[model samples]
Target: MKLTAISALVVLSKVISIAAHGGVTSWTVGGTTYPGWQPYMAPAGQKTAGRPYSSYDPILNPVAASLHCNNDGNNGPIPQSITIAAGSSITAHWAQWTHMEGPVTVYMASCGAPTCDSVRSSGLQWFKINEAGLLSGTVYKGSWANGQVLNSLEWTATIPASLRPGAYLIRFELLALHQANTPQFYPECANLIVTGSGNAFPSSSFLKPIPGAWTANDPGVLIDIYSEAAKSMTSYPIPGPPVWSECRTLKPLSERC
Candidate 1:
């Protein structure tokens, strides 16, 4: 149980990420079209609980946020956006849903807070979502989205080392839904932990767990993330020059849990 902040690893480049993070979006997956499926959860009922949903919600932390059903891309705050050093590799892995028990489709893009309509290259990565075991049909195998695009689920791109930091959001739009009418789905919002080059946390080496998988109901599991534990940089200060314009991204549900 250790908290790891990827940004706080070491101050090197520019600053980015400035917006409020509501909290994480959650999901429990199930489908048969694919071999073993990833975990997916859409808003199951008519109404959603809204913010203040998770005690550890990033919105409360301000540096992060989350959205669910009725979650239109009409300009929502971003949670867990941070700065990065040059030449850093940012990666992620996810699964999408077309229907409850069918294939899932997910699209990705790189945009800032005020306007997140910017579309970046996306991955065709596929993962099983049909009530599969846990991970890719293995233990700890559940992931959101349904494809085999590795870069899609996991992103590993290098920051320009001279890129600027600002408001950004990783839009997770659902191509399919369990029901047709409501254009909303579940969320497992990711918590971004800053890390310096070579996974270094220079500040005080403090590791604090930021709970991501908790719901309004259910027991809680915690994973500690170490940021600039000490007052190294300003609260969510922007990263320096040479940045990964769209590289600022997220983590997995199981790892957070």
Candidate 2:
């Protein structure tokens, strides 16, 4: 997410200079970096901070249509999609996280067609692929930037071997809660064509639409991480829909987990 001065109330006493924000610059599979989105390309009046950069002023409200593609309302999909086999591992290299923290999760939404190379993420069906929430302890467990990848640039996740073969959109989201009073959300989407299939795809029960998936008031998205840190909290409530169970649950998609 982009760190707009207006969205965050920086504690002057905390630090002298605050340069925070980041984006997945390149996608690497098996140690090879592939082409990907131009970080911070969607927002209006954004400066080119170089490859793998974070944006400022994240998509504020979860229901906002801008949530897709990091509000890259004007940009389309990348020219080529990264190719990987089911159950393969991929890593996103960040320019830098700039001391930011929070839960970083990867999601996949099947484009209407088998390939999402040229398709946008407007109405796709998305499900959680990998999620690293508050790992353990209270010091920084409940915060996004405090997760295992804190201050680090790269995050890796594996494609489910059970995923059906085809092209899909791999969306990455980082919810920066450093300024706990008002959280910032940074979401990016990339195109991918998966080979070597599986039988069980994410059922409708586990899928959700981007803009409609989260709300500003959701407990996970709207919490005071700083306050929790002060009290030595133990657990955190992750925002958005629940992780899909291998056994389908006949529940309405609109109902949040």
Candidate 3:
């Protein structure tokens, strides 16, 4: 006899409760790997492009300023920016991920300043680049985009080919819905100097503020994955605005992580 999807999810939740939550340990940009900020370690002099965060703890409140990155992601010592061309791929390598359900999304915000060091996360306007939620199956029995990330220990996103060259903050996010009543948000940011000649940029309509992008009442954030209603659904509504048109044209939802 096999356990039902609901029962399986309950068991998974129990495991997640005891397991350590994780964050991005490093990032691979254009085949080069850069270390991510580790809260436990002392600040080594500008060794990485990733912003510093306080810990691996997940952000439970979507309205918190920390949701833009992670805890202290905007206040810590700013690391140097990494150079990468538009249309390239960047992969985030997580320390560990045991959660089996939810979506993995990526967003980009222009730093506006000469370097990202001077900019605060609260002031930037972000636009989605990639988002992958439930790909197929029921909420409990279906295959999820996060499942792929869990198996690989890494998630990748592509920069828009037509994006203008400038300083930007690339954010990597994992929303674990194992306990959907209170979603777990794990987000990290990396400084980037995008090099390219293309001039396409997201318009005002495409830009969304981090804390404002999500709410507790959003269908995706408040869902119960193990419920009968969720099992009958065919699609999952990914939180936040749609992906930028330029990025969507370059990589459709089917191709994104």
User: Of 1 and 3, which scores higher on TM-score?
Assistant: 3
Which candidate has the highest lDDT of all? 3
In order, the Cα lDDT scores of the candidates are 0.23, 0.65, 0.84
Clashing pairs in 3: none
The parts of candidate 1 lying over 4 Å away from their true place are 1-83, 93-145, 149-162, 166-175, 186-257
Task: Give the candidate order by descending lDDT.
Answer: 3, 2, 1
Residue 143 lDDT in candidate 3: 90
| Candidate 2 steric clashes | 14
TM-score of each: 0.23, 0.76, 0.86
lDDT of 3 at 252: 71
lDDT of 2: 0.65
lDDT per residue, candidate 2, 96-157, as tens digits?
56544567788887776756644656767789887776666563443443355555677888
The candidate that wins on TM-score is 3
In model 2, state the lDDT of residue 84: 87
| Candidate 1 C-alpha lDDT tens digits along 1-257 | 13346555433222111111111223211211111111122323212112112221112221122332122222213222333333343333333222221122222222323322231112111111111101233112223232322224422234333333332222222221122222222232221122233321111111111121123221111111122331232121111111212222222534421
TM-score of 1: 0.23
Name the 10 consecutive residues with the lowest summed lDDT in model 2: 45-54
Better of 2 and 3 by TM-score: 3
